[model samples]
Target: MFPAEQTLQLRALDPEDNRIETSAGIFVVEGSAFDEGLEAVAIDSWGTSSCALDAYSAGDVADLGDGETFTLNADGTYIWQGDDDQISGRAQRFFFTATIPPDFTLSNYDQVLLDEKNSEGMAKAFFNTLTVVIPATIILILIAAFAAYALAWMKFPGRALLVATVVGLLVVPLQLALIPLLTFHVGAMELLTSVMGTVDEDSKLTSVNWFGNWFGMSEGEKIAGKGYFGAWLAHTGFGLPLAIYLLRHYMVGLPRDIIENASVDGATEFQIFTKIILPLSFPALASFAIFQFLWTWNDLLVALVFLIDSSGNTTVMTKQIVELLGTRGGDWEILATSAFVSIAVPLLVFFMMQKYLVRGLLAGSVK
Candidate 1:
């Protein structure tokens, strides 16, 4: 349907049916569609020092060859990489129109794994899963390493009780702690904001809240005042039990003379732990890291409760896969391919570190 109001105009080109104009304005005269939409170039904004992205938004004129321009628009958010700093990102134009593809190949990968609106948004979700899994794995490992070293080598008050408690927690279901932990996480953030924040009334968040973007978890990034920080702590809490139990057993198995001789040389416990224990306990650390990484990577429950909001900015792969299954459940090809996309990373991770995994699993696995 050409514009009914405006007089139709066309170039002198012949066979106008397949020649959709790619330049200026989208125009369709009589029996053919010759139209132009928008064009956006994504020059990489990534700087050398950091992942400073050169982001661009697609122009609003985007539309399929529907003979109607400006009628289809969608939010196209794509996140590439994320560290404690800002995430690498890009935006695409998601235009929707009802039309058949010229041909159907293996496109389930596209349909199930892509799209800004209903598709799983696997690209962002993959990086988002990384954002949660990597940090959570690192945090839990470091904390557990310290706790394990102290428990194994140092004699402190309540040492036995602490070990017992960690062991006890290993049996506790993480489900039991989710609600309580989220409540506490939210409360603590609010308390901090109230105490040490410059409130920005327009956004209803402190202009500069805790850590103040030093770690890149600013107030604006929070959903219900919880985002990566909350998710990190949540994963850390659940993982600490197993992390400590495994590491402590492994640390205790370290040679007594090495630790005693290090202390005899007047080396501090911190030095011993860093220089001696860390190097020696690499396998145990790696094994726990693998387990922790896999747990957080595949976890939908913790991600939903602690990280993701209605905005879907912080969604992880597991949740995204669930959305795909829910929305495109009938499409078996899509479900199959989507399942592959979900496991690819974990499989790669497992294979890469599998040798250490075996050593971690067997080395003084229990006290």
Candidate 2:
């Protein structure tokens, strides 16, 4: 409901009589489509009000009681004095009070999902973000777990220095590497595709179609192009430092006797890591998985740099939301709907992994 201070006011009423009134505009009371209330409507001579009036009609003006006010019709038209009077002016700005009810409907989601022509739609971008996040999270977590386990348990020279270096990487700001990494990915991908193209026609590598298919190419094409692979590698590189640091600390605190006992029983290093340390470090792994998934899922800059190319077929949810801002600037319905859709995944992941997040935070903090 509009406050009394901001409510539309009838500043002036010309010829407040029954004579042949010229340019007479009468206001009417009408129910708003948005809410159940009496909305005040009036026209401003200065045209400073945001509302615009279309036409005027001729009818008896409604009487206003103590707290009552007049509202314009939905079309912003009302009847004035008589047939001779014609309301025509340059500064005829229409003003109206609007009350909105607290309600929600699934139509917005339906439109966002089903409207393919909507460049701002979340359907394709949502899946594209998933493609970037799922593989990136899984690959990075696996690689980081192995590195963290090695740092925690392996007896090697300069091990402490290596641990220090990994921990130090956590302090490095990711922004510094943005330009360099993008440059590297672009250059490296060109070289990689060139080499792939130069491969022999009858080579056994080409016989395996996995490499070609992964890059959105055919075996005959034999070229690795820009796609989810580059984005996955970029996220892995950025996420590895934190993943290793967190998992290493948690792995080091596990029962040392259990690992030693596994070794005494003639278990291989891989076995002990897979069968013992991996299970015990679930909290840390889940914590990092949530972090990396949410980060990669919500990333716009990295996706723009590595994943999305000139085609824009692989745009992620974040980038799609940004495009919405430009095209649908005034449409708050589409903007708000797209925003919530982008955030929905992160919210779901947080709620599901909250226990592990708390456990990871508390794990190495205590003695």
Candidate 3:
């Protein structure tokens, strides 16, 4: 017996003998049938005041009995039976034949899963970018401010040439010197190791069991050979030329009268720069910072050249996004999400610094 929410159980008979048994209540059957074995049975309701049996057969079926009993001679059919003659319908069921193209397969589900994973990886990449951004910004601003003041106001031999040389370097594309620079970095690291009495026969920095403790490094972790420090140096080096050039121009453009007046009041160069020049050059410094922040934030080639293979330990956001795209191109959703995440930091930097960008630090320089 079967109710609306309950299922009916039925036993299968052999292919030749199709026997249907109906109890006193409604019965429902749902199952497939074999070619030489029992066929699928369908029983919606039976023996009720309003009962109907809709039978769907694949082939010509020999109804062995009336509403009470049904049989199939050859092919299989779905049969729905009802009592009290309230509803009765019979239909033939046919086997469906689908032709799949030779090249096509089910791939939508896999693509969706891959896209989700890529999106997560992209988020991690954004975090890495922040790690690079915050420290690099602070370092650049400090170094640039000091250098700018020295070149602009403080008199020294070769100061003009030094400023000109740094500006001239802006013409040299970074791609041209990438390899040479990396080689120099590697060699310098080795030299530092040798000077510190830590070089091994293979020229690698020897592990110092005690120094790690002093520096709070793990017992076996390599502290100085290559790592975050190396990356920071590379970023600072690449960022220095433009930073120095822009900042020098802005600082040099500060009011000469202000400096002369500060000097007349018995102010030292350090005091003048710290108290007068710095406060006045904030706009120029902020502008240069925005430029450097964006360039370094979106940098992929530099990261690849310097920090490749530093995946889990030191991989940046750019590298992470690139890897995700290469591995999961089919995942459009993930790609879009990753793209937006990567841009979010630069966007914030620009929006935050935009207010001060309009001021001209050179306003009172000439006068």
The per-model lDDT (C-alpha) reads 0.66, 0.67, 0.60
> What TM-score do all the candidates reach, one by one?
0.64, 0.66, 0.61
Better of 1 and 3 by TM-score: 1
TM-score leader:
2
Please write out the lDDT profile of model 1 over residues 311-352, one tens digit for every residue: 989988877767775542434445567778788888999999
Which ten contiguous residues of candidate 1 have the minimum total lDDT?
1-10
Model 2: number of backbone collisions: 5
Off by over 4 Å in 3: 1-116, 195-220, 224-226, 326-333, 360-367
Clashing pairs in model 1, backbone N/Cα/C closer than 3 A: 21-35, 26-36, 45-54
What local lDDT does model 3 show for residue 246? 80
* Candidate 1 Cα deviation (angstroms), residue 70: 41
Query: How does candidate 3 fare on TM-score?
Result: 0.61
Q: Give candidate 3's error at residue 261 in angstroms.
A: 1.4
The true-structure Cα RMSD of candidate 3 reads 16.2
Top candidate on lDDT is: 2
lDDT of 1: 0.66
Clashes of 3: 8
> Candidate 3: which pairs clash?
28-43, 52-82, 53-80, 53-81, 53-82, 54-80, 56-91, 57-93
